[model samples]
Target chain A: TQLLEQSPQFLSIQEGENLTVYCNSSSVFSSLQWYRQEPGEGPVLLVTVVTGGEVKKLKRLTFQFGDARKDSSLHITAAQPGDTGLYLCAGAANTNAGKSTFGDGTTLTVKP
Target chain B: EPEVTQTPSHQVTQMGQEVILRCVPISNHLYFYWYRQILGQKVEFLVSFYNNEISEKSEIFDDQFSVERPDGSNFTLKIRSTKLEDSAMYFCASSDRDSPPEAFFGQGTRLTVV
Candidate 1:
């Protein structure tokens, strides 16, 4: 069984602070994705990084895939109250894998 | 830019009752999936459907659960019998062959078993 573990289950910070959430695993994956979910909403795809050592940015958020494809990270620069939400990472074994196992997620709270 | 859509933002049912959660995946997507998130818990994969058949399902997807495409656009998940433990938010997702790993999810339906 593959397991994706996310760090800092909960984080509270003031506005303008920078933070990073991590997702680590013992197994390699062919692809990984990051999602942000607000209350009462589904997981919204933030980005998908397929190559090891690859990085993608979406405005204030930066996602990096591990060099070994066994881990990933999300970095938020100058996080504002609007950046607050549950961040999740999911990994797939290969292109054909029907299901992607998800991490427990990190709940981030940014206060102004 | 299309999105997956799920019906009945919330559902309430009694123990031993049957409930069917419905979803309409993106018209052009190929892979469809069902996942559940218990209150304060992580989202877990229940099953995956493709090509008019079930491609994969997690251990949590037992005999009590069933999934069907039913039509060209609708995918549904049926719970044969409800239990308190089944109370959670169910989300439907779809991805296309162009980018098989980028999945779009529905807002989800919150199922409460009384």
Candidate 2:
């Protein structure tokens, strides 16, 4: 089974602090996606990186797919209280169906 | 903006009872999926459906679980017999043919099997 492991399961920081969450896997994937979920709600897609070494930015969040396609990372610059949520990373296989396998996720709490 | 929608935001069922979760994907989406997240755990894929048939499913999708489109607009997941461990938040998602991997998810149904 392909498994994605995320680091620093829980994080709490003052507003404006920067934080980075990492997702690593022994298996390679064709694409990777990041999502943010609010309490009691489904996850909302943040960004998708299909190419190795690819990087995408959405407002204060930056997502990077590793060069080997076996890992990815999310970095938040000057995180605000609004940025607090559970961040998840999912890897999609090369198959046409590409059912994604998700990581355990990192819960972030940014205090104002 | 178009989005997936699911009904019965929460459900409470007795163990061994059958339950069906409903979802309505985006009108133009061609790929549909069901996923579940146990409390404090990662989201796990259950099944993926395309062309009115199941394209792929995870080991978690056993004989006890089934999925059906039933109609052009509605997709459903049925649990034949619920167990205490079956309790979780079930999410329904969909994506277009243009980007079959980029899924848009619904608010989810929180199922509590007692």
In order of appearance, the predictions have TM-scores of: 0.96, 0.97
DockQ of each candidate relative to the true complex: 0.64, 0.64
Model 2 residue A46 lDDT? Answer: 90
Q: Model 2: runs farther than 4 Å from truth?
A: B98-100
TM-score of chain A of 2: 0.97
lDDT of 1 by residue, A61-96 (tens): 899999999999999999999998999999988644
lDDT of 2 by residue, A1-111 (tens): 889999889999999999999999999988888989999998898998988999999888889999999999999999999998999999888774848899999999999
Task: State how far residue A12 of model 1 sits from its true place (Å).
Answer: 1.2
Candidate 2: deviation at residue B109, Å?
0.6
Off by over 4 Å in 1: B98-100
